[model samples]
Target: MKILLVAASAALLGLASVGAASAYDGTNCRAPGNCWEPKPGYPDQVAGSKYDPQHDPMELNKQSESISGMEARNAQRVAHFKKTGEFVYDVKKIPAE
Candidate 1:
């Protein structure tokens, strides 16, 4: 009876360990090919800078430009499909200069 109890306890412990390990596996950000590494000195720069604005306007401008560019490309694709009655799959023709 004692031997059976010991074997059961060991099995439970093994399962518990496996569950714990799997829980941590999903937490790794590098699981995907794209992972961001923080640039050196970035934290110190942000800490030292005065708060002129709640957020950086340049960053906002870049985001706005990216959104607008994507919208324009999508519009062009829709227009081409409407005119030619075919989907645009060519990468060269879809990208905006």
Candidate 2:
């Protein structure tokens, strides 16, 4: 009975550790943009400024541009469809034009 109780306790501890490790990596963000690692080349501040090795502005800008352009195009298409009474859109044509 004691051995069984000890085994159950060990299993519970292992489960808790696993859950902690998964809190960040399981998120949607991956690659340089979302993960941070310290680099030695950068300047160290007197106050010890925070360093994020995952800083990739290019990827973030790409995501932002893609999302914004799609949203704007969708809005324009909706407006055009309302005005022209056409529910269908051409894949080859630009939105609202």
Candidate 3:
């Protein structure tokens, strides 16, 4: 009988927890980003800081240029390897992070 009572109490506590969880109206943001319900008409720049990279044309241009440069370098490496049966390696003395 004591075991049954304890189990019933635990079940009631679990249901109460569920009820408490469902009470959230979704405006509040939790640490791990549970920001589902954002306020309507939210501005693109918050406090003069653009968070989304998609909106920044300069950033996109920089990324595209970087990718193109990498591809050109890789193509050069491939061409050199094909012409001479030796792989080219740029031995840069970059410090380990």
Candidate 4:
């Protein structure tokens, strides 16, 4: 009976450790409308973290615009290639200096 009790206690301790290990931290805020933003008066380390979207809204907008433009250009290129089995290139004729 003592051997069985010891075994049961060990098993319970192992299960408890596993449960603690599997607990989640709230760092993953990637769902829709769940983006993390910096809060005022927080610790500098937490406030200045890399994932905060409210740091520079204009920079984010500029980056988004650049990406959108690149994607649009890529889509146009793909459509052109599909229509005419040839790739497109901009061959600028450099003036003889």
Candidate 5:
């Protein structure tokens, strides 16, 4: 019984820690239209982060707003997928420039 209890607790802790590595803070979504696309398994939004480059709408002002912005943002998202092997959400934490 004792061993079983310990094993269960350890397993639960491990599972909880797995998805906690990468998280969005939600501070980026302050603007009116700001938002983020959530990954399949990760949480939709973090407490203090928003405007994830991966999932957020990046281009607002442009000649062809729909076409150009989408193309550029999609290209960037694809590149990110290649590097991380996972899709980024709109609430993604931006890396330091």
Candidate 6:
């Protein structure tokens, strides 16, 4: 009887997993543009840590913006290196010789 019950449960779980396709991408909508943003202070009440990056839009945006700034700086550095064969962290700060 236990073996039969276990087998049935396993089969049900397998079928359930197969049916689940899309996952919640923080906005509750799989598509873009029309995503519903959660009300401020609402997500904080959810049963999770305040620092969970997966659900924290502010954190994710902050990180993405920081990365973009870093990439821009890196691109500038690479361009300067290619043009001058030297790496200068801040070209403006270096006094013109």
Against the unseen true structure, what C-alpha lDDT does each candidate score? 0.73, 0.71, 0.71, 0.69, 0.65, 0.74
What TM-score would every model get versus the actual structure? 0.38, 0.38, 0.51, 0.38, 0.29, 0.37
Which residue pairs show backbone clashes in model 4? none
lDDT of 2 at 32: 52
Q: TM-score: which is higher, 1 or 5?
A: 1
Task: State, as a TM-score between 0 and 1, how close model 4 is to the true structure.
Answer: 0.38
Candidate 3 on 14-79: residue-level lDDT in tens?
A: 999999997875577665466665467766566654544456778769988999989987877776
- Compared to the true structure, candidate 3 yields what TM-score? 0.51
RMSD of 3: 8.6
lDDT of 4 by residue, 1-97 (tens): 9999999999999999999886855455688568575566555564555655465777769988999988877776666667777677531222212
Clashing pairs in 3: none
The per-prediction tally of clashing pairs is 0, 0, 0, 0, 12, 0
Q: Which is the better candidate, 1 or 4, if ranked by lDDT? A: 1
Candidate 1 local accuracy as lDDT? 0.73
Poorest 10 consecutive residues of model 6 by lDDT? 21-30
Off by over 4 Å in 6: 1-54, 91-97
- Alpha-carbon shift of residue 55 in model 3 (angstroms): 5.2
Candidate with the greatest lDDT versus the true structure: 6
Residue 96's C-alpha lDDT in candidate 3? 23
Best candidate (score: TM-score): 3
lDDT of 1 by residue, 2-86 (tens): 9999999999999999999867443337657654655544454454465325668888899889999888878887877887787
The better-scoring model by lDDT among 3 and 5 is 3
| Model 6 TM-score on a 0 to 1 scale | 0.37
lDDT, ranked from best to worst: 6, 1, 3, 2, 4, 5
